[model samples]
Target: MSALAAGQRTLSGHLLAWALGALAALWLGFVVVGFRTGQHEADELTDGHLASVAALLLSEATNDFADPRRVIPTSDGDNLRAHDYQQSLSVVVWDAGGHLISRTGDAPLPPFAIAEGFATLELGTPAVPWRSFARWRAPAHDRRVMVLLSVAERDDLAWDIGTQVAEPGLWGLPVVALVLGLAIRRGLRPLDALSAEVLALDVQRAAPLQPRLRHQEFEAVVRAIDTLVARYHAALAREQQLASELAHELRTPLASLSLHARLLRGKTADEAERQQSLQRIEQDALRAGQLLGQLLTLARASRTELAEAAQPFDLAALARRVVAEYAQAALDARHELVVEAPPSWGLSGHPVLMELALRNLIDNALAHTPPGTSIAVQLDAGERWLQVCDDGALAAQKPAPAPAAQGAAARHALGLGLGHRVIDKVAAVHGGRFEQRPAPAGFSTCYRISLP
Candidate 1:
């Protein structure tokens, strides 16, 4: 994943986890509250029913007070009502002095202060949960009857109710978590689309970003990217402008230097002075031509729209043509130039640039080698090479070696008499390198341009 996408996914994962936890905590709290409320309502209803029963019994005991023997046996008759209630209740009756006069069941009633109204209390050996209410009755003038009713249910029932209340959250939590995860992923779709669009952009073409955001959230980010791209274009244009101006400014000084040297050559009348001036004029003209050519090449090479028209052409034909064209100059310098390109040799490139590059190589070879040396241009098909060799100074003075094994250094060194700027630029434009190697006969220079 890209850095942006990975970061978004991490954020979503953490958010989903936190949301699920928070929702689960809230669901648990609601379940707990519901369970407690349900238990309170159930206990209240049971306590109210038991309280009515206690009141009815107290009335019966008061009515039968005149005949103690007819009041029913301790085990049978009217006391049987107390026995029936004893199944779920423990009853205790007391006078105003806190003395217990009537009792039913085995569990002891906790100590209670005598009061005029009802009060609830919990009881048991293992501290059983119960609801107890005391009823205060003053039937006659100064006599009072107190009845306490306590109902006990098993602890297991309370737990069962609590578990029942938590059922919904247990079943629904995973579903909510899944939904949240999907929602987070869906919400980040715009960002993913935006990243893909950005990656598709090509700096050369410099097309504008698509205005295709799915939501308003990414408006600022998209705008910022667009602004940055505009700035880059502006910067690139400025650099190109500066390069053009610098190249233009150098041309005038070069022209003036070439003109002055040429003018001085004719004015010097002495044979020695005339010869020296003529040599200086030729050297300065060559240098001026070289600098202008390099500036032009550099300007055109970087243009994106600039493209070479490539075609298949006979390598030997092209090599022979350049050698034949420069042969007269070779003859004038007392040199023997030979073309050794075979008819079967072939290569392909932009014809015009290749011609320029081959001509520069020929010029450099002729300028450096001594008179009467034979220069041969050979097209080797087996090695896919066009080799130019010279039989002068090859085993003696060689040019600088190539920077790297793959990097071919142009051998344009001519003891400061010839300029290298033109040859280097031509090689660069043709995407080739120049190298001079030691030969048994003399020095040989090769201008190797890769064919596309």
Candidate 2:
């Protein structure tokens, strides 16, 4: 699976898998330890029993028989058949000369090749495979006693002991799994509720998501989400306010254009009147166009659309170019335009945005400043700052005192107009601000955009 797909799986699945895997490992370890312990215990008990039987039979032979090579009769078949354990066991005795002294119950001939101790004999058959213990009664007697038991019987006992030891855990596994599954489901209910809240959120309406989560683990995530939602709501409100303002600002020029069009259509009895009407229409159209352009610039500045057009360029050169482009307009307004900067200073940013900000500043100065006003465009290389300072009539106008209960949009509108707002936004995008203060002559306003 892809890494992303693997990561996207539920946390509960991973948790449950790990939990079950650990439990399984523990369960396997219990089974192994139980089986080994039971097997070891069975071996000790079986070997001890064989040793005791060999000792007892040797004692009986030494006491009862006068000849060391005498045979013992096992003719009482009823007594032998009554003992269940004896059916699975065999005993044999031999003399030093390899003569079989005595034997019982279909005992196989013991291999004297093995030294006196416990040993396993294959016997070349599946059913009667043997486990045997042998001992010499004493060196002087020249007799060997051998005791044998079936391997299958010992294995059966060991398996039974192991099963008894492991039975409880084996039976409890399903109950444990069920309990764990229920615990996991209960533990994840908070996350499920949080997910539902998130899914139900309405971005257009700027709705907040509030989930009653009991987990402290989700606190940070919830706080971050709430913060983002608040920011989104603020941005939406600002855009709505801007739209209302745009419509209000455009109404006057549109009404003027409409009135002039009617006048032109009426053929009002005189050439000069018709010419005046056309000029008025043209002026209103220009005003409306300028307003729309300013609004578009503001929109672009507010969003990331202009950021994609960013590139490294010489800021001083761009400033000089903008100054030159507006020089003719300054001349027509009877204003002096001056640029003070180095020949070149490198900067990385959206050049179009910088140009737009510069043009707006210069145009504002040209339109609002009296004739003979001097507008200066200054570039400071060390500070990476650009400033346009204009001595203008509008610059002389003092800001009105803010009302105590003024809303944010009202305060913003009071502080800036369409062109000024666009310039301010452009400056903000470049990590700077616009500044306006009284100059020594009349008044001075500066647009400063910090460059990187």
Candidate 3:
């Protein structure tokens, strides 16, 4: 399977597999331990019984029996056939000269090779397998004793004991598995409920999800989702505000255009009167055009795709170029336009948006302040700051700048609400911000864009 497919199992499937697998392994270990323990114990007991029989027969031979030909009967003989005693204990007593003194009817003959300790061997005419223990009587008598037990019957007893011990656990496995499956399903129900709530949520009217349970594992996820919804709500509000503000901004200049047209409607109007009305109409047209242009620039700056297109360029060179382009209009308005910068201070930003912002800042200064104003474009290499500083109208009289001054730079400073939002959008797109304050020295107002 592909790696993705292999990892696609449910959380419950993984949990159950691990839990049941571990339990099965533990169960198997117990069964194996029980089997080995029972086998070892059965061997020890049967071997002990063989040794005891040898000792008893030898004891009688030495103390009581004068003739070795007498057969010694076992405590539980043929009458105890159900106990399989005939296959269990078979004794053979012998003389030192290798003559059989006495032997059980079912007993295999003595092993020829050795006469001491426990050994497994095949003996007698047909060579039937037997487990045997041999011992010699004290040196005075010169007699040997060997006891035999059937190997097959001993194994059956050990296997039967192990089966009895393991049978209950084997039978209980299915019951245990069913209970474990139920437990795992119950444990995951909370997560399932949370998923259902998330799916049923209304994004248009998003609200914070109140945590139904105090589960630490899901707290972080819930908080993140709530934060995302909050941002979405803010974006919707911004869009609505933009539409309302744009309509209000367009109303003033359009009304002027309609009024100027009325003033020039009749043939009775003189040439000078007609000329002035036409000029004012043209000026209002320009104002309306500039507002639309600012809105367009804001829209372009807000594009997500353009944000990723940053490239290296000289900010100082860019600022000088913007000033040079606007120089003729500044000269016409009798205003001073200058750029101050280091030789070639490098920076990285989207060059198109930077140019648009510079245009807006210069345009704002020209329109808001009076003629004879000094417009200084400042660039700081070390701090990555760009500023446009302009001298406001003299303290004697606060009047509007000339027609030449009214065309371009938008002051991001206080009072021009639409212009403020335009500069803010441009600055945001550049990963920077614009601020306006009283000029430190030699100027009245200063607008600055700082990029980190």
Candidate 4:
């Protein structure tokens, strides 16, 4: 699988998680606050009502004393007729001398002395507490009245009110979640479309992504994908061009070898001619082998295989070694090969790529220049540059136009080819470039692979 496929994550899943989490948090917060507030309001109303009832009862007791005929009723039927909340409440009236005047309901007696105004009476353990309120007649101070209610009953009422407040949200949460899920899916529709577009892409004919996306969030992503696709297409084109060039380069050598082989097999009367034919076949084979090797090196450089094998080495020493390898070839061509560089200097890069680049440069100089031409291999450690200069008339000439079928060997003969491109690729991978320019004597070409 591609890295892109392996690293894929669902946008809708993330959006849904965040949306549901935020909604749940808000719901919880509202439920807690509402429950507490409802309970507090219930307590306030119940306590205030209790105090008011106690005061009213004391007033009624004072009136009853003024007129004995209308004395407050002690019968449950009469008390029930007097108040709406009488089912959940109890009342008692007492004289100033501590004599019970009247009472109603099954409420327990006060756990403490009757106070003048409002007060709570806990009639049991803290875990199962009951509550009551007492009031004494103010002007006459001749009577006291108390109203009682259960703590458990009051709590039940508060809880009912709180649940009523929270009922709508609790019931509607699933619907809200469904709406949020749909919204998140709709929001991510563009991403799904983009994914489809990417999946339909043909790597060989890939093009930049069109900026037809409506969402701004995906603009950067689409542009990045376009850039990546463009790179893939360029790499593919380079590989195809390399294959074509390799085919073309192999054709001539193979033809020459076949012709020589046929001539040798014809069994000429002259042994010298037969020997020359064999030599020609061998030379053709060697040429083909050399071309193939250079092509392979170019392919490895293009694929970035060399960069993966990079290590620290002496740049100056690598230069000297490359120059030495070509010294014999230079001598055979009657050319002077000279190296000018530092004793030792360190650099981090693929030594194989470096050697291949340097070898290509030296070979290009040798192949293009005359036999007596003087060639110099110069390395500048500080600048991280390697240059090959040849004082041949052809070195001053412009390189021939690239053939339809281009390869390292053909390019070397014309002073520019696959070898130069491979060197350029190497320099680029190392964060630099390959340059060709005029030299003091003829022409100089250089590769600068900068060190970081």
Best by TM-score: 4
RMSD of 1: 19.4
* Model 1 TM-score on a 0 to 1 scale: 0.44
Scored by lDDT, model 3 comes in at 0.75
True-structure Cα RMSD, model 2: 9.5
lDDT: the better of candidates 1 and 3: 3
Off by over 4 Å in 2: 1-87, 92-107, 116-118, 124-129, 135-146, 195-213, 269-276, 293-416, 419-444, 448-452
Off by over 4 Å in 1: 1-9, 28-87, 93-106, 109-113, 116-131, 138-160, 251-452
The number of the candidate with the highest lDDT is 3
TM-score for all predictions?
0.44, 0.62, 0.62, 0.72
Summarize candidate 1's per-residue lDDT along 175-283 as a digit string, tens digits: 8878888998898777778888889977666567876535777787878888778766864784476456546755655665666566665655677766666665555
Ranking of predictions according to lDDT: 3, 2, 4, 1
Higher-TM-score candidate among 1 and 4? Answer: 4
**Local error of candidate 4 at 154, Å?**
0.5
Tens digits of per-residue lDDT, candidate 2, 90-197, equal: 778776766666665444566776688899887744446788988877646577778887788778776777777777777777788788978998898888888888
lDDT of 4 by residue, 91-151 (tens): 7677777766666554555533655555555564333455678877777778777787777
True lDDT of residue 50, candidate 3: 87
- Pairs clashing in candidate 1? 392-442, 394-442, 394-443, 409-434
- Superposed by TM-score, candidate 4 places the C-alpha of residue 244 at a distance from the truth, in angstroms, of 2.2
